[model samples]
Target: MAEQFNFSSPPFDLLRAAERERLSEALSVGYYAAGETLIAAGSAVPCLFVVLKGVIEERGEDGKLFAQYTSDDIFDIRGLFSGSSKHVYCAVEESITYELPASVFHQLCGANPDFGRFFQADLAAKRQLARRDGQNLAEFILTRIAREHLLPAIEVSAGLALGDAARLQLSRGADALLVRQDGELGIVTRTDLMTAHFRDGRSEAEPIGPLAHGPLACVELGDFLFDAMILMTRKRIERVAVREDGEVVGLLHLTQVLSLFSTHSHVLAMRIARAESEEELRGAAETLHTLIATLCGNGIRLRFIMQLVSALNEQLLERLFELLVPPALRSRCCLLVMGSEGRGEQLLKTDQDNALILAEDLPVEQGLALMQRFSEALLSFGYPPCPGGVMASQPAWCKPLAAWQRELNQTQLEGQPEQLMRMSILADASPVAGNRQLYEGLRQGLLRFAQEGERWLPDMAAAALQFDTPLTILGNLKTREEHLDIKRGGIFPLVHGCRVLALREGLEERGTLARLGALKARGVLDEGLADNLAESFELFLQLRLQQQLGGARDGREHGLDVARLSRHERDLLRFGLHAVKKFKQSLAWQFHLESR
Candidate 1:
């Protein structure tokens, strides 16, 4: 028997330990001299080849470079299984490969479904499997939350006196107590008990039910800790009751959840909120890359990761505004995060697209100065200045409520290309802090303009169709400079198409997926189409994030290197581009853009 094969890479990594041992026993080492033809095009593949040393070059029928396989790389699985090789595999250098015989491969496939599926699965299926594998990793936060991590629910009868309940809780070392009252359960935290006793001047003899809060926030024992953290953040509650089969099993405290993830978004959000100075906020912002890498590496769904990043970014912006602007000034203006940040789709810290909507009758100079300081502080805190000057620091964007409304009306009426772009940016604007009423007034005006100018939607939607989807008729990517612009080709169509639909339907949502859902709910789009668009948009986002994380030069222009993607990923990209084409055609038909 040869040395044991390393099962640390994909496809092989999907195999079980026993299966790896079987494979290790069955595989035989083979060597090829440079330029030797290993597998000829149009010929049958005898076995799967796993490169052990040196490199193999795969060439098409025309002798074009198709792909390269190096150490630890597997090749010809598809050809071996299908019984027909599509490309010529030749050793580019003196190469050694561990060959798994066709019989053993067939036996393994028959024995292990997962191992078989890993080679045959489509990109989406492979992505799901990868996510499952990530979930199984020891470092993923969700994997850390076990049965032992949950604190047992300490219950007390509602009729019991507060003093007795406190003593019982203390004896049990419980941070909270579940009180049973009128055949229903309520939660009373230690803080609640203390507040009841110290602030409300409640007597020890008083019934504990009066201090209990219900209906309590509850989560299932099997729920992911990430979900629990989101719930806690949304509810602004410190504790959630854990239940199983309609029975209270335990209580999950925020502290315990935090303990499971030290560098998680929630902790970073907390740090951002607590930062007293620009330097402290900078420290928190600095951890964003690590957080993103960890989450992405763990295969967390890109959409959820974007939402978490958006939330943390919002906190950072809000904290920066608080630290920069005086209370009186802050209250008078609504700080709006524009563009991707405004839409809650931004994954990385990009440019700062923000505006300050001041209340009527405020001095423009004072507002400008405050905004300048705020924008400068954000720049210091890691947000780059907007290239188009779409920032609070700009006098044009830092405007009073009436001015904003007037500008919206002007842009809607004019409908010029630049004005349309401006309107689109404003359409996705979401307020991060300050006066909500002012922001709402501006939003209502914008919506009203959209209603009045429904004819302009065709033109707005036309932008989505500007760039041809970079997909060939053969279902391969048509690339310029070996790269396909994922953003302009795929993301823009879905995002702008959703935006136009949202505006026409009077939807208030800013996020592309949310707007799609709203459009579906409003009968503007069917469930199937909406779902396809959502998945397509998500795929585009994931690819774009991967490209950014991969350190592509000028991410806005260069896009994703199509050649660098895995075979399944390329297939997924093609599928996503087809979705974009469908969306574009839908937009054209719906808006009657073709007639224009």
Candidate 2:
């Protein structure tokens, strides 16, 4: 027996002093030559193996390779539970493994719940644990909920005169007053009172009940503050009621939510909404970089940051469209945002990707001029023009609804690379503003196109497999190159793979995570793999964002320096790349890519 286990790594890293001692003392190094089978499928459980040298391959009952274990890689932890092997573990070469007795492992698991949970959980949960290992405070700060930031709602009776209600709201310094009427709750804002008095010819003496809006949009008190923020943004409201155990307890306003992070995102969002001209919009858009930096520095989670940035970008684009597009033509067309922006996964200001869909053919040369000016205006606002010219200004992207459908159908008939790329990009396209029907019409046609073609998916799926995972799982978790192009090597594969899966399943979700969840629900993708891929994709985004925030002024990076990361960060990167590999392999198997 020797002290061979590295307590510095994950799972072991989660254990305390005494727990580490127990593991260190029980660790025994054993040598196995090449082609040695340590455990066969259905065999009784043996000691857990932690590879210290060489490589080991995990193959399923069908003898298909599943995973590889290399230096510092642990395997067969499932033996701690069922006490039997479900896969064949064979040494790929002469290797040394730290054999921890099953009984000792169980004792250590019981001694450290966090350590135990990591081994017991699925890939998703395991990755989450690995990320939260030494970052408890950061996690808590980034995941604050509505309950922690509630503003005690000032409730006013419905019978109270509108004038008294308005005065009460002013005296209490509340932006909105809740009115309880007939076992229902309603909300009245200052604007509501003013509009009623001026526009409806009603005096302030009227009952507050008639002025108040009922069945208010609400979020659970325990809901994450980011989720509450999304609710208010989507509903176009200033505040939301917070409910606790089926009863309204408090309210969450825009200002209070924005206060969680000392950023000017709210102010910027308002400015975009109220902008009357392109110049005014450009002035507001200039502050976007500062807001992104502020939010990132405040330790906001990557998901929340992407969502908030996406929402603000949408508001900006919509406002610009309103100012530029004629009122007469606005009802005749739909504006769509495609690619990362459409997916709501973009963090920094990347290139512009948008399109316009008209309802029918109409003579409007002036409208076309405005559409062409859209891209130039966006470039002036600091968003770089799309390299491939996917902007709405291009005639290829700006077309009628029927023309868009025809192009998609033509892409299927003739497998052109550019057309395929457009389809892939269009898969993530979503309407930011305008006629929702036009967007739906295009989506339904695309869905039908996907449903009709069966063998064609393998060709569409080939693009997802174009890139290789950068980290080496067969060796020590090391990068293949000095600098890793994480976006292409990691993010693209995960995103495109998930997109192909969604198309095959006919899922309407445009976001990668949302599609993964939908695919998992339909049993089209394994739950563990789905969750792992999601967390891994997010890990890539987080890594890229960190790199971008540090430098990557263009939002496109030269590469990610793996050597610059901490031990924990480096480990997460390796683990995430492995998730991408698993997902890519699954896609290959599903599409029968090998046979092709």
lDDT of 2 by residue, 425-523 (tens): 898898987777889889887897787764577888988888777755443344555578887778898889888888888888888889889999999
Looking at model 1, which ten-residue stretch has the lowest summed lDDT?
133-142
TM-score of 2: 0.76
Top candidate, metric TM-score: 2
What TM-score, over all chains together, does every model reach?
Answer: 0.75, 0.76
lDDT on C-alpha atoms for all candidate structures:
0.80, 0.79
lDDT of 2: 0.79
Alpha-carbon shift of residue 46 in model 2 (angstroms): 16
Candidate 2 backbone collisions, by pair:
none
Looking at candidate 2, the ten consecutive residues that score lowest on lDDT are: 132-141
